[model samples]
Target: MGIVRIGQTEITYDLRRSSTASERRITVTPGHVEVVALTSDDEAEIDAFLTRKRQWLFNALRELETTTAKRAVVLRFMTGSKIPYRGRMARLTVHRHGGPHIEISYRNGFLVDLPSWVGEEDQDAVVSSEIKLWLKRRVRRDVLEIASSYGRRFGLKPRSIRVADMKTGWGACGPAGSILINWTLVFAPKAVLEYVVVHELAHLSVRSHGPDFWMYMAKLMPDFARSKGWLDQNQGSMNADLFTSTRPIIDAT
Candidate 1:
């Protein structure tokens, strides 16, 4: 995989070797690009092909934004909303007067307690707030643990780890040995989250994504590309479900 910056946006694309393909072709998805070319094509040739499609890639990305926005509210704070969390899909069940306080619990699915005092108009906003906070808290703890575990293995320690909202990318390795993981990772599977943590931690050892860097990544996680591709392919839909997941009524009694 390689990254090319057309303007403000950086396109991350994977170059796949094709056996029977006659010519180079580019595929654009939400947050990923794939360059399919003959196996004999060298790195320079692939880069040239990517360069030729730069404008098209830029337009494709812009279209993805518009398309994603159109379906932004696909999932909302209503009953039966599919919640993509921790590598699994769970139905959101909202229980009115389920408890004296707003509580979030996970069994086979997510069970949220919406106190009776809250007005109907405020239900969506309130539930959305509680879940966002819950996800922030959960991501912070998980990131620390994952970073620490991998840090130990690699004999590297990050100065700090924090979960924050990001416009793009899953995690960031700060210049000061700190790591910032996007809280939205709550919507991703554990493996995907772990991959992000490992990615940032690797930055501590190697500052750039060069040969040495990927060598370390492959050593750390053999199937790193799979998780990487998953994150790229699922960039939009997962986050949509997270912020807009509609909830259900559970018997609080």
Candidate 2:
């Protein structure tokens, strides 16, 4: 780790020199900067390389800091914590009773009853797991119903529709007309969830996302853009990570 002044800004960077690295690169994250250079390159060379990338690093760091700050709405699974479902926020109410099963009922948000044996220390994990399962099951049923309804009308039937715990993408259509959707979409608004289902179903007809494909989307759902925009704007809060980490960047040449 070293401190170097890049123009008007003072920058702190963790520099690692690798013999196998073919070229130099810099990574910018919310916390700090990381620079990778050649093992044979001297301090001057590294400094020059960093100087060339000074502006990009500053811009990337500023943008990432702002985004991380705005999206750090990590709400743990606890009573009174507002959780999103079907495009609305629900309040969680929890209770412990004499039973082995985890009972859940949704009046406005959610009401839960856990076994008396469970202690306070285990409440968060237990609640998170049970609610996630409940949401996944509901999402699966809805996905199947929507897929079936759309399939009947569009004449495009999928061999299988599965809900998966995917982290990156929302949904995908594989060979043999199989559609896999991320289970996390259960937290999205119901209309947004339907948009994802119909989107994949359309893929059974059109392979790539060309004009004809969008034409199909428009015919199926006239106002899909609103849902898509909602997902786009709130994708950062889809996960409940409390702290920022350095994600891998596209290596700069």
Question: Compared with the true structure, what per-residue lDDT tens digits does model 2 show for residues 1-253?
Answer: 8876767778898888878889998866445467889999999998787777777777777776676666653234567766667767888888879988999888898888989888854676777777777887999999999998888887878999999878688999996889999877877888989999999999988889999999999999899999989999977666524322324333465
* Candidate 1 per-residue lDDT over residues 58-129, each given as its tens digit: 776676667656665423565786666787777889988745799899888878988889886477678777
Best by lDDT: 2
Candidate no. 1 TM-score: 0.65
In angstroms, give how far residue 174 of model 1 lies from its true place.
Answer: 2.2
In order of appearance, the predictions have TM-scores of 0.65, 0.65
Candidate 2, pairs of clashing residues: 86-189, 87-189
Model 2 residue runs over 4 Å out of place are 1-76, 240-253
lDDT of each: 0.77, 0.79
Candidate 2's TM-score reads: 0.65
